[model samples]
Target: MAEFDVVVLGGGPAGVHAALAAASAGLNVALFDENASAGGQVYRAPLEGMRAASNADQQAGDVLRRELTASTVTTFFAHSVWAVTGDYRIDATGPNGPVHCTARALIVASGTTERVVPFEGWTTPGVIGLAAATILLKSQGVLPGRSTLVAGCGPLLAAVAAKTLEGGGKVEAIADLAGTADWARTLPAMLARPGLLRQGVDWWRTINRARTPRYGRHTIIRVEPADERLRATLAPCDAAGRPISGQRTTVLADCIAVGHGLTPATEITRLLRAKHRYSRAAGGWIAVADQDGRTSRPLLYVAGDGAGIAGAAAAATHGALAGLACALDLGAANPVRLTRGIGPARSAHRHAARFGHAMANLIALRPGHVESITPETIVCRCEDVTRAEIEAACDAGARDINQLKAWTRCGMGPCQGRTCGDVAGELLMRRMGTASRETVGSFSARTPLRPVTVEALTGNFTYDEIPIPKAAPL
Candidate 1:
């Protein structure tokens, strides 16, 4: 069993900064990432022999990668931590083989994934998540399709549209659930970070230059196969995302890239039994943590998107704070080291969080949107569970998400409810007339958190002879 002073999960901006901070403070740290490389989804590295467009954001990721390599932190790439137990013990499978590790303190910075709300024909071959499209374009230098329609909420819509155009892919249209009024309302909070505002302006300018048709307060209600193309039905929506009785439009698209912002990847956090609360603005259920990233569990911390939906800037700041706090807690560093520069980092985090909150509010999914799900629409693609099936389970007296799971197997798929849990919970909430979605409860996390083949587990198994106890005297 390998051990370290600190174990940081994930290799994104947050984990990188945390490892650097702790290592520089004279603490041995091990950083584990599932990817073959360090960069997370946002700042993912391009494939070999493929040159990605140079930018400040990518440059920052490069700098972090270099610093991590130069630091004393031990990095394990292609390592997926499937289970954690007994204080901070971790079971993972790395490129070489299975690894067992323990740490005095643990920092989770696992980041976020696209929050998907299923629509009719969403399981069609041409449909993909906005994050998937971004990865395909940026990392693999592959276009999602020749002509695509980018739909859904949040800043990612515009970002994906702009990236598609830059990659020389024709964008049929860009549909946003938020209208002009939404952006106007969020302007004050967005102004907290002038750079982010400027970046938004730049993305808008790019889309404008492409002359792509941009729709506001609109959503793709359904999609159908039309030969090799996809026919998407678009309709106007109100503030609550309820469809309005207005003229609808249809577009022929080769691909549909859609997403409803992001939700924190909280499987590991939930498995750890850390306290959490539901906050739509924070991207659903998130680990309850303080400014220093300390969670309810002692010596266990969370930072980055795993803690909440704050973007990379805030994630890095929180990571630094958490690292300092961990070092101080372990007596590995002086108290002055923990206090130094923390004030500025916290202030910066606040500014970034303000902008993140503003963006989240603008793109938050309304209840009506979930109500719009058709009975036939597939909610859990992995399990082939439809809205009708879930509704039937609820009608059969399944009161909460866990009961509904046993009744219909909606969240018992390979994705482990990552794709369908939120939507299912909302459906259950509506059926039970729960005051809040949280009342329906989140899916209880169990190990192994990720899929692990039996072959791997058995291959790593070792047999040890045990002394048989003599029969106890009666």
Candidate 2:
């Protein structure tokens, strides 16, 4: 068991900044990350030697790595927090056994979970997520497929298509859900961060150079596996983002990479019972917090994409501000040490968030996309609950996710509803229009955030040998 002045949950840009700031303020800080190294998805550390790919991300990640290494913060890599008990006690599984930590303040920068809309053949082998494709290209030094058809909303469509081209993979087509008009609307705000905008423009140029057909306001209707290849059917979407039934085109590719932006990974926020509200543009129900990421829960802050759908730059500043907030609120440091730090970080965040918000709006989930789900489409892959079954539950008066789980067993699988919860809730929300989204709340999260075997849970005493946690000080 260990205790600290602050404990940060995640090693992404936000969490790293938070821990560094808090420790810099003369506070004992502990940071935990699920990956073997620090850096979450956006600034994820590339394989040593390979360096995987390039961009501002590479430079930013390097600087972050150097600073974190120089900081006094105690770092725990490959540590997954399974639960938060009491005010700010962390229960996690580390290298050997259970890691117990109590802190005066806790910063949750768990980041975002990639949101993928369900389709007829989403479960097919060759179909991957736009986010996952980047992981393959950036960290694994491998391509998604020989010929990948990239489909989705937001800037990732162009970025992934371009990266695939860079990795020597053929890009058959780029299917974007946002039309030209929609992108035009975001231009003003996206221009707030000219560097990122320039990066995006470069990606588009690369895509065009490869002669990849780009379809605007288009979405993947479905993908059918044909021998060793995939036949992806796409159609132009209406104003609401629903596919126009009759205008379908098929693109042949060995793989399909599709995604619908990202949602705040709210398992920790929900477990801690922070206030939540629905903001479609911010990627569904998010934990409500101040600019410094202070939540309803006392001394608990949420930063980065976990608070909302802000990009990596905004997340970093937001996290540092949260750390400074902890120092101020918890009396962990002198006011003089933090006064200068807070204002500059806040201004930087506001500037970066302008571009981030524009991107969020671009990838916002549209009602028509969720409504377009066919009756046969599986809503919960873990439990195989079809859209029809979920709708039937809604028709039978199941409003909240808990009620749906009770009646239809939609969230009863091993996942306990992480992947399917938001999409399932969106289905339920449509049934109760004008009603508060909070009324149709998400699935209640319990301990052990991720699935664990019984042996791991019970210290493996009953089945095999394993280490056990030493009793804490009485």
Q: Report RMSD (Å) for each prediction in the order shown.
A: 3.1, 3.4
Q: What TM-score would each prediction reach against the true structure? A: 0.95, 0.95
lDDT of 1 by residue, 1-474 (tens): 999999999999899888888888899999999987777887788887888678766787788888888999999988888999858998998767788899999999999867778888999999999999989987898988999999999888888888888889999998888899988988898787888788788888999998999888898899999999999999998887777888898989999999987888888888889998888878888988889899999899998888878787788888888888788888885668567757877887887788777877865657888888899999989889999999899888888898888888888988889888888888888888876977788898888888997766656444565456799999
lDDT of all predictions: 0.86, 0.87
The alpha-carbon lDDT assigned to residue 308 of candidate 2 equals 91
> Which segments of candidate 1 are over 4 A away from where they belong?
458-474
Tens-digit lDDT string for candidate 2 (280-326):
88988789899899999899899898989989999999999999999
- In model 1, the Cα lDDT at residue 115 comes to 76
Model 1, residue 295: distance off in Å is: 1.1
Q: Residue pairs in steric clash, candidate 1?
A: none
Clash count, one per candidate: 0, 0
Q: After superposition, how far is residue 95 of candidate 2 from its true place, in Å?
A: 3.1
